[model samples]
Target: MYERLDKLRAEVERCKRKVEDDRQRLKAAEQKLQEAENTQILADVGALNLSPEQLADFLKLVANGQVGSAGTVSTVTAVNKETEVETKDDDDYDLEGLEDEEN
Candidate 1:
């Protein structure tokens, strides 16, 4: 009888360990799936030509359930501002000085 009780206890322990391992595997699989989904989303967003700031706003809208029927006005405005700044920066460089230095 004691031997039978010991065997049953060992079986119960084994079952518990197996359940825990399966739970761990399930958790890992879920994490992997989430990472893959995020990667796909990033790729799709890149294809849309959104800047980093626009992308952040887009993600925020999606997360807040406010993405429906939103226009591209904000993103376009942000990109335009960035372009203006970049153009101004390029204009600030002294091209004549660069030519003189090379000569």
Candidate 2:
């Protein structure tokens, strides 16, 4: 009878410890979920507020030199300017060809 009583007491202690561990895990999980919810809310706000052009420019800026990568603002800006000039030159050529055809 005494041995059986000791076993019951040990089992109760084990159950208590397990319950405490489960409670701690539940609390940590809830905290993590709350953090994720906050992050998602911020992302939604940004998506709703920033226009496509603004978002594109921001991404370009980050990709260029802001993200700890090996890129410089000067280089990225120069490349973009170069691309614009090429596009403008192509437009000029098209206009010239149209003028020649008219003549």
Candidate 3:
């Protein structure tokens, strides 16, 4: 009976090790999947930074219209340019509330 109990205990210990190994493998796979997703998202963002003509064609398709209105296209371009300028200006100055903190 003692020999049988020892065998059972050894088997249980082996099974626990196997379970821990499988869990670690699962965690690694999930991390790889997340990294792949992040890489794909970056690629998509890069694709969007195309030339004006290419961007206009893409927008037309996304809007489901054969032709986008000239005014709308101009407005979007202007807004993008303005935002770039604004962000550059923002970088020249420290953030308002953060700079004034006592700490």
- Give the candidate number with the greatest TM-score: 1
Give the Cα error of residue 26 in candidate 3, in Å. Answer: 0.8
Q: Which residue ranges in model 1 land beyond 4 Å of their true spot?
A: 57-103
- Estimate every model's Cα lDDT from 0 to 1: 0.68, 0.63, 0.64
lDDT per residue (tens digit) for residues 12-67 in model 3: 99999999999999999999999999999778857767656555555565486533
Sort by lDDT, top down from the best: 1, 3, 2
Tens-digit lDDT track for model 2 on 4-96?
999999999999999999999999999999999999978975875655565566467767654334332222322332232111223334477
**Tens digit of lDDT per residue, candidate 1, span 1-103?**
5999999999999999999999999999999999999999888878978677766765666677644343322212223345421112344556997889999
RMSD of 1: 12.3
lDDT for model 2: 0.63
